[model samples]
Target: MEKKADQVSVWCIVSMASIPLVMTLGNSMLIPVLPILEDKVGISSFQSSMIITSYSVAAIFLIPVAGYLSDRFGRKKVILPSLILALIGGLIAGFASWKMDDPFTMIIIGRVIQGIGAAGAMPIVLPLVGDLYQDDEEKASSCLGIIETSNTFGKVLSPILGSIFAAFLWFLPFFSISALSLISIVLIFFFVKVPKEKDEPVKFKEFFNNTKKVFKAEGKWLYTVFLNGVLVMLILFSMLFFLSENLEKVHDIKGIKKGFVLAIPLLLLCTASFISGRKIKGDIKTIRLVMLSCLAVMSIAVAFVGFTNKKIILLLAVTSIVGIAIGALLPALDAIITENIEKELRGTVTSFYSSARFIGVAAGPPIMSIVMKNFLNGSYIVAGVLGVILLFIVFKFIKENEIGNQTEKA
Candidate 1:
């Protein structure tokens, strides 16, 4: 029987939710501060973006490995050490910003370490949520939605916090991440408990063979879902970067005002995720419909962002629509992928999906920096075109039964 949200362990929910909240704070918190970092740290536009990219680049490579290790060793063992690594990274960056004459490179290195920690923590939370609920599909879906909402919630908070911190000291955002990570570490260590399972560890050779078999059987729809994830994230982050830079460069809106403006879309996104997660509830048809509809909204809204430069309100209206689209898209992707994969391989499979998403994250800032520098409108054009393409791919390939069968099994 399905359980209500309140019936789930409160501590498990809190601990699970904290993982994404902290991860988002670690990364998205830097968005509003990127422009300031360029001047304070003596870096170019592209170099400043690398502070974000360095973390994602490391995460994109290590995430799958972390997933596999989690499946082998259990989730908490991997998670605790990962939290420590993230704390260490934050400390390194915070110290460099305080003491070093040339701290930019050191900060980037610290971000890379933070990314490694991220690989183990946030991505694992999906499967860990799946593991927590076992056969309780209703609770899993609800909890997954809440977890995703937490991720978006962090985004909602990051810009405002980053702006506030950077206003005082340019490096305060980095230090704040350390404090946040420390809190998550304590919560997870004390509050989160992974339910035990009796499955034996598969040998690497057998594991590869099974993964390959699963891919060969499911790669078409799986690849489409993976690509869709990449496209959505790429568009979202790239546009955020563009918006952040433009607010400062064009509108002279900096500090807290800019942070509030950035938060507008993210707030909408966060609300959408919370509502979508509750409404979707493991239904396959709902997943496809919501994803497609959201992509359509995103495409048109992004295109509009390109055309309207003079009116901040117009930009806010369009970008808010883009936020809603992204907000809905994420939880749907998580539900579909989680439902489709087997329990034993869920971590590994989702890790690869997370890695694909991180590739978009890693690429977004640099691409935005380059495109915005050469032609400001080009970033929106790219976002719109990619959305259209991904929408088409999903419409054609992602089958209802593929999702239905998985949901039925759950």
Candidate 2:
């Protein structure tokens, strides 16, 4: 069952890319349609936000375990089962919405199931790319960029797709998740081939010890990257959730039209991330510098939003800047975390990083609900402060490519 590393086909890459693409859409696609969901389900914004939180919370705990399992077994083995579980989770949510009188609890429980599946499918894509091109660093780097781009592309499309689905039937996006995951499952099963790993599987104790050693040496920088992941997602999702309401209620925009306006920042993010990833490439110093610069830029833009006087154009423009800043910073975070980690430990470490990001996603909406209700004008200010704190952390703790040099030497 061992395959040649160089045998990687374009179809193979495309198949692998589908996992993140679909998994992201499963969550993000809900944002635009949340207003409708709130009304249909007779749920408060806070309650509706729990739908998102439930999914993320499940992933937040399970991703690290999925990472360990992927390392111990094989990437495909873990991913295939995860997609099946996600598909089932999607059905439960969809049916509860469609068929049940009191579906709220069922829907939440279903999302938790989906979240469990998400923990495995989404984060595993990273280390799998690294494994696929073990012999060719350039191709590994290129494919990683592709994976990130696919993920961002999902963000760009999700709102529109979600809105379109909702416009037809309020609960349709829930069912769509099942369809999307099925496609990825098929593509990966038939087309992709993982080269066999040569290393013996490490036991739980040794695995835990290795993780400790890796974290001990690089914890300063890795923890910074993990925090950055969380904060960026927190800002991104909270704003999107906030804006979805603003568009539907305040601006009287809804359906596909609203989805497009919401997509503006996401489009900016998707475009900028692709450009940033290409430019930063494995240059650790460049990655850290870009991230620092982006954090500062985003912090300023978010604070400016507090003073925008609610001018539609001004608000959108400023938020767009925040999106672009995130776009630039994320690729840097990914590069610094994964490229520097030794291959054997990449799955566990990146899973932890992915899990941290989910913490932000889970926290964003409910926290934002409170922020908007209590301190509406200061929402931007509070988010800005978090950005500034993260910027300071990156500058002080994230060494400039030093980890990369150390990794190369080791």
Q: Report lDDT (CA) for all predictions.
A: 0.87, 0.86
Off by over 4 Å in 2: 1-6, 405-410
Clashes of each: 0, 0
Worst 10 residues of 2 by lDDT: 401-410
Error of 1 at 251 (Å): 1.0
lDDT of 1 by residue, 1-410 (tens): 23333334688698889999999999999999998889988889899889989999999999999999988888889999998899999999999989999998899999999999999999999988887776767667788899999999999998999999998999999888889899999999887767756777888888888777778777878898899878888888888888899899889999999999999999999999999998888887888899899988888789878777668889889889999999988998898888778877889999999999999999999998887866768768777888898889889887787643533322
What does the lDDT read for residue 225 in candidate 2? 90
- Superposed on all Cα atoms, model 2 deviates from the true structure by an RMSD in Å of 2.0
| lDDT score, candidate 2 | 0.86
Among all windows of 10 consecutive residues in model 1, the one with the lowest summed lDDT is 401-410
